[model samples]
Target: MELFEGRPADCSGRQEREVRVYDLLDRLGIAYQRTDHVPAGTMEDCDRIDAVLEVTICKNLFLCNRQKTAFYLLMMPGNKAFRTKDLAAQLGVARLSFGTPEDMLRLLDVTPGSVSVMGLMNDRDNQVQLVIDRDVLKGERIGCHPCLNTSSLRFATSDLLEKVLPAMGHSPILVNL
Candidate 1:
């Protein structure tokens, strides 16, 4: 895959969700690099893309409380081992589980295998809390799926935290893990 600056000139055949991500970034005046590839669901599939982007693509998890009333979007180092018990303690919440595909779609406008911070744009209700790893914020740049597993995007970490998240009405709670 090759990286191109900003939105694709020809977005004609792209999924609407993907297109919306690009549109939001452009509208926010945030520059990004993009590459198209086969849908990536595993780290092995992402290694090549990660190499090209020169940043570890954060692993995004869609999680919810036992009642499913509170939802969270977590961005963490792809290599970091995740332990629900650990995260639950940090967030002061009861047991958390992977959100269902149905809630993922309803709130984020994204299906399984394609969760990212970009999806927060669709959560106008601010129902989903953004939880990001402190390590992720330390990176100068971050790579992530553009609400579609078939494509990936790289953007300045500052733009995401300072501009994008605020615009999306998401104030991330930084976690060390």
Candidate 2:
């Protein structure tokens, strides 16, 4: 797969999820800044990445309501703490918990570390909902993994909302948290 360095690696030779995201971005006419780094899913890991990418990485969580009927992909500022009670109250759900890895793979076609908004593309059934934190929306550019944890992509937040999400048949729900 492409390293997400300045140059585009030969993606044709790769058949990974990251390659698919890159292809989608290219087809959508969205320009982006990509940077390769170590795998990061926590604040400390994101801190190192932020130093290199000059942008905060979002905390992408896969969750389900108490009944497991409603699934969500919540993207928020990595540094922010997750308060389940607060989210449950705002969402009007009884309770929420991290979905199992099996559920994530079945519903979003993604593994744990590689969870991302781009995974929404796999949810053709519209089983998963997207929730974006208000703070993350304040930035002009949003950084996320390309369906893989090894590298990251930076693109205009507007492009993601206006083009990518629509193309994937999903719209993000903006929430303050």
Instruction: Candidate 2: give its CA RMSD in angstroms.
Output: 2.4
In order, the Cα lDDT scores of the candidates are 0.93, 0.83
lDDT of 1 by residue, 1-177 (tens): 898999899999989999999889999999899988888977788998998889899999999999999999999999999999989999999899999999999999999999999999999999999999899988999999899999999999999989999999889999988
Off by over 4 Å in 1: none
Q: What's the lDDT for residue 47 in model 2?
A: 73
TM-score of each: 0.98, 0.91
